[model samples]
Target: MVFGTHRALDSLTLEVPPGITGLVGANGAGKTTFMSIVLGLRTPTNGSVSVLGLDPLRQGAELRANVGYGPERNVFPDDMPASDFVKHLAEVRGMPRSEARSRASDALWLVGLGEERFRALGTMSTGQRQRVKLAQAIAADPSLVLLDEPTDGLDPVQRDEMLALIRQISSEYQIDVMLSSHLLEEVERICDNVVALDAGQLVAQGPLRELVGDVEGVTVELTEIDDVPGSVESVVARLTAAGLRVTREPDANRMDVLGASADLIADAVRDAVADSSARVRRIEQRRRRLEDLFEVGAS
Candidate 1:
């Protein structure tokens, strides 16, 4: 997708499969632009777009019927009550009036807004408003749901609650979710697969585990033994001699081991500690982080 000379979304061919998939990128990374294209709200300047086996451009109505969208920004009417707002959207999605009303109430309850269902949207807090957006999106039970930064303005507790609700949407109803977020941690916590974009270009795409394989590093914390002089240095020497690269931090009483798989590192650490008569306080294998995807893309 392009606007004037700037390519909002560059030439990209990607497929989003079932389950909860995260759409991740930094600000202005074309996350919203991609969502717009998928929803048929913006036509791609060059290539075609499809959602749920239907062309978003040609079969827009049908595609929308099977899709739900929760925009990043709040675009609700101030005077509209929460229940009315959600019900109206379900009706727009072709649900019967009675069904839409029932679904809307149920959705509000699911989002923890049942008590406030009669309250006007203008009177709700930011967190409450965010739930309202979620309620409206899933009220019609669409096959696919597109959420743009669902936790944007939420506090830490509210963020966790919202994430749990998102996970529930997929696990309970078997709905597919493509949630866009600048928060990589949020994506890492709930998404099974991820698609990352950088300046509108596809940077990374794969299952979360495949993308962030086990990091080749292990951390070992040594128990202090005042009687054992140079215990830390002795352990380091033993580990290095055992063919493992070790970096020691005497003050912190920790060593970072590299140059081998985590399992090998652990074995080497155990052997080294036993030989040096050093007690171990803790040991853990490090895991690759999701943020590494963007770092690689930037490079």
Candidate 2:
């Protein structure tokens, strides 16, 4: 996507599979431009765009009918109650008036605003208003929902609640979601898959687990934690001599195994400890993280 010769999205290509996928990047990373293209609000300069197997540019009306959108900014009318606000959007999405009213009420309830459905938008808190935006998007039973920065300005507690709701929407409700955010930890915590963009270009895109990959590290602890005085340092020195790198964790009794298999690393630790007849307590594989994605993409 380009605007007046400024490229907004360049050579960006990826498929969004079913389930909750996160679109993540820094500010000015062209996330909004990509969403607009998917919504048929803008055309790409050099590439085709498709959503749910339909050309978004040609089948925009049909595409939008089946795809819900919750924008990052708040745009609700101050005087309108939540129920009326959502019902109107549902009707505009081609739902029957009666069904729209009922669906709107259900959506509000789903977003945890059952008691506040009749309250004016002006009286609601920012968190409450955020839920309303989400409620309206899913009111028409869209096949997929595009959520742009859904947790923006939310307090920590509200953010957790909202993330749980998003997880529920995808898992229980079976509605596919694309949550766009810049926060890596939040995406790591919630999304099953992710699409990362940087400077108008694709950085990385894949299932979160695949990107994080299998455990490439481990943590080994000694049974002598209560007596780890000399044994721990001896094990570390031996592992260093045996070509296995280890780092002492903040907790003095444990050390992280780096650049080696869990079994081999554990063996090295045990052998080192055996020199002084020390016993092993436990060894755990460390899970992968989002930082791995950046490393792989940079490489």
Candidate 3:
């Protein structure tokens, strides 16, 4: 619903249960807009949106009470201390002053920012600031949390830690979470459900494994081809004759056989070795990742 006159979203619809759902897309893919709509920060130009059984547009206040939001962009008062900021946010959400302070400490500790609680927000590193934002969002113990690019500006170690924290929050805390990200690997690692958008349109949406399905392919590594040209041609001919879509990567000394099973790959390898002294160093059957699905679906 967080769309514009340019129509950043095209009638996108999805249902998220009490678990982590990853919303993914390339840049300008409307992921942020979709999260904004769900958070009641942006109203849809056309479709209706409900969060926790309440209309986000009309019941925004009530909806927001149970929803925690961590935006992709940086948002914090530079002069305020991390603890003060989180405590203030908790109190603003209707928690008692004493309870808010305790909850703020707990949230900061949960995000590994306990020692930095008293540090000025401006003095903290980008990763620390990001943690502060996340802590504030969850300090109120909301039922659902929306995180947009939560690992941005983090190093490899920090990214891993943040992902682990997110996983814990969803699993141990039992909070329903929806995260928007472009990193396909991260989504594949942590998300149970995925809703993919491209150029402001919903392209794919389903459970991760179901969306990927069985589009795995086999990579054949060839060797010992005295007559490279002829041997490769013959190999391709034999595979195609067997009704497989073969894509040759000449530079890599490998060919991908699509829509083929393990037995087929083994058979092709055997035939290559017998018919032409060609050696198959390796026959690897790899399941396609989410990125592969995106590329295939996009094409």
Candidate 4:
């Protein structure tokens, strides 16, 4: 996908499986472009998009009926009541008026807006408005939902609530979700799978565990032995003799033992600590995160 000279998406070939999948990347990483293509909102300059086994370009109307969308920005009319707004969207998606109203009410209640369903959207708080956007998206009972920054403009508490609601929609409601968010931490929490993008290209896409993998080393913080000088250095030498590479953190009683795996490094640390009689403060296997993917991509 290209816009004039800027390539929004290039050589992007990815398959998003069922379950909650996270779309993660920095700003302008083609996350929005990819979602737009899946919704048939923008015609790609090249390649085809098939969402849920249907061509988004040719089967857009049918696809839209099966797919729900919670946009990043507020697009609803402020004067409209929350319930009416959600019901109107369901009706536009071809639902009967009676069913739309019922579905809309149910969705509002699910999102914790049952009491405010009839309140004008303009009078609602930012968090409430965000819930309204979510309510309308799922009111028609879409098989899949595309949420673009669903937690945008939300406080920490509101963000947590919104994330929980997202999890409920996927698990309890049995709807597949493709969530786009810059918050890698939130994605790591709820998503079963992940599709990472970098400058419109595929950085990585797979199960979250597979992509995060394991940390390269183990971090060990040691308590200083009051009577022994260079206690930390002795421990380092013992570890080095064990055929493990170690990087000592300067001005701190800590070091990272580098090895092939965390288990091996951990085993080596245990032996070294016993041999040196070092007072240990903390020891744990460091773990990689989604942010590491972008760092690797940038390098």
- After superposition, which runs of candidate 1 have C-alpha atoms over 4 Å from their true positions? 219-242, 245-257, 261-283
lDDT per residue (tens digit) for residues 1-299 in model 2: 77997999998879889999989888998899989998999988887887988888899999999999999997679999999999999999989999999999999999999999999998899999999999999999999999999999999999999999999999999999998998989999989999988878788898998876567777777755455567677777788888987878554767777878878877777788888556778877866667656556677
**Candidate 2 residue 55 C-alpha distance from true site, Å:** 1.3
Q: List the residue pairs that clash in candidate 4.
A: none
User: Candidate 2 or 3, higher lDDT?
Assistant: 2
lDDT to native, each model: 0.90, 0.87, 0.83, 0.90
Q: What is the lDDT of residue 96 in candidate 1?
A: 96
Q: In model 4, which runs have C-alpha deviations exceeding 4 angstroms?
A: 213-217, 221-238, 247-256, 260-264, 267-282
| Alpha carbon lDDT at 38, candidate 3 | 87
lDDT of 1 by residue, 1-299 (tens): 88999988887998877999999999999999898889888988887877899998899998898788899987679999999999999999989999999999999999999999999999999999999999999999899999999998999999999999999999998999999999999999999999999999999998988888577799889975888877778888888888888876446678789998888889888888888888999999866678878878888
lDDT of 4 at 43: 96
Error of 4 at 162 (Å): 1.3
Order the candidates by lDDT, highest first: 1, 4, 2, 3
**Candidate 4 lDDT by residue in tens digits, 1-299:** 98999999999988888899999998999999999999999999988889988999999999999999999987668899999999999999889999999999999999999998999999999899999988999999999999999999999999999999999999998999999999999999989999999999899899997888556788899876777767777789988988889877576787878865888888888887777777889888766789978888888
Winner by TM-score between candidate 2 and candidate 1: 1
RMSD vs true structure, all candidates: 3.9, 4.5, 2.7, 3.0
TM-score of candidate 4 against the unseen true structure: 0.88
lDDT pick, better of 1 and 2: 1
What are the runs in model 3 whose C-alpha is more than 4 Å off? 1-5, 213-217, 221-227, 242-255, 258-260, 273-282
Measured against the true structure, the TM-scores of the candidates, in listed sequence, are 0.84, 0.82, 0.89, 0.88
Model 4, residue 29: C-alpha shift (Å): 0.9
